[model samples]
Target: MDSGQEALTLLLLAPLFFICMVIEYRILKKRGYSDYSLKEVVCNFSLAGLHQAADLIATLLLMPFFLWLYQFRLLDFSLTPVTLIVLFILQDFFYYWFHRASHHIHWLWASHIAHHSSEKMNFTTAFRQSLTYPLSGMWLFWTPLMVIGFPPSAVVLIVALNLGFQFFVHTRIVKKLGWLENIFNTPSHHRVHHARNPEYIDKNFAGVLIIWDKWFGTFVEEKPSLVIDYGIPKQVNSWNPFVTTFHQWRTMLTLALSTKPTPFHIRLRYLFGSPKFADNAEKRGTTIK
Candidate 1:
């Protein structure tokens, strides 16, 4: 879809987003998960808006590349209804794996940590995207859709729609939808994804479907007794957009450069290991060596 069309769709979907948020908040209140303060919600969403603006600008600047890919044979030109549905599903499926990798891979985590840095779960949190994702190979994961004959327009539309669907999943309001929770990614499932608790960490990586998490062994049920602590263990407290995007990158680069003659394995681990691996090494009194 063109940028104008995408913007129109987002405008149309805005109401539905608010409706879902209200429904979710009511549910969370009923379930007693509504302990958060208004200030926390405002702060989180404000930072998220800044991040989204940066992302919007980046995506706009890169539209030419997307157009070129579409004009050539690299991306398909078909736009039948069936093709569109397939494209949407394919994009989401790839998103599931990409989201999972962002948690598992250290370098990717450096780019993704901004989203999880917020210690709150709300619809706005869903908008907390990484401005550095374009530089982090995130677009490469969706190339298969282009290769499989999805037009660039269709690809972009499906992506935006997929993201629109995910906005509802970020809230703490919706509890369970019976079997729906098992088949689809809901607020309940996403809460687990944002949790910092031991058992909740690195779980629930579905975008629109919960089946992906179930099939991949990353699914975890929400436990009321285990209070969900949102945000990374080492939080990035700054509201500055630039700081949020490059803070982890700076830290990782420092660690890598400071380790002289680093073995290939350690270098690879530094790039792909879990976020906590470095801290765990410190706790065990180990260094690169």
Candidate 2:
């Protein structure tokens, strides 16, 4: 599917998104949890708009490259229900790595940080995406599916479905779903992913299935005694959509410029190294050893 049709697929689901958000908002409000705010919701959807626009433009520009790259496929298979299921699993596998890398690599974290910038974990928090994903090379993660002989359109559709399924996992409304939690990414698991708590910081990177995290040793069960604190380590501190969207990028650039008279690799590290490296370097006024 082209970007237009892919967008329509998401659009058809927009009402569902809105309805979930509304229900979650009402429940949280009645329960006396201050998870939603008008300012944050507006900013969240604003970032969503920016993210969608960026994705649409990037998809249009990169479709031909994906198509050209498809010619070099190692294998070709017709799209069947079984094949589609396989593709979905493969896409989720790739997404697990992509999500993991975004946490570990500063370059990608600059784009992903915005999604975790909000302290709230309402349904709208899932809408808080960064426009910098295209620049950060998120699409490259899915190119492997194309090279593996899946049609680019099929890959894109599966990606949309994967992300759509993820929206439900962002809420705090649902508790752990017994056996479902064993195989799927539940709200509890995702809350751990969004938590700023030490043990939860890099855990639970599953896009849809929890098995990837379990297999890779990144899974952490939510602790009832340990209250989850949502948001990144360094808070963005602003509800302004633009500020939140580019705060980490600005921070990364500043770190790169401030660490001056250093080796070229050190400067690159400011942009590409772990975010912890950047944070510590900025604090100590020197590179991480």
Candidate number achieving the greatest TM-score relative to the actual structure: 2
Give the C-alpha miss distance for residue 7 in model 1, angstroms: 4.7
lDDT of each: 0.74, 0.90
| Candidate 2 Cα RMSD (Å) | 1.3
10 residues in a row with least lDDT, candidate 2 = 1-10
> What does candidate 1 score on TM?
0.83
lDDT of 1 by residue, 159-253 (tens): 77887888888876567889898789988999999988989989999999889889888889998788888888878777665666678888666
Backbone atom clashes (below 3 Å) for every candidate:
3, 1
Q: Which candidate has the highest lDDT of all?
A: 2
* Shift in Å, residue 72, candidate 2: 0.5
Estimate, for each residue in 143-200, the C-alpha lDDT of model 2 and write its tens digit: 9999999999999999999998999999888998999999999999999999999988
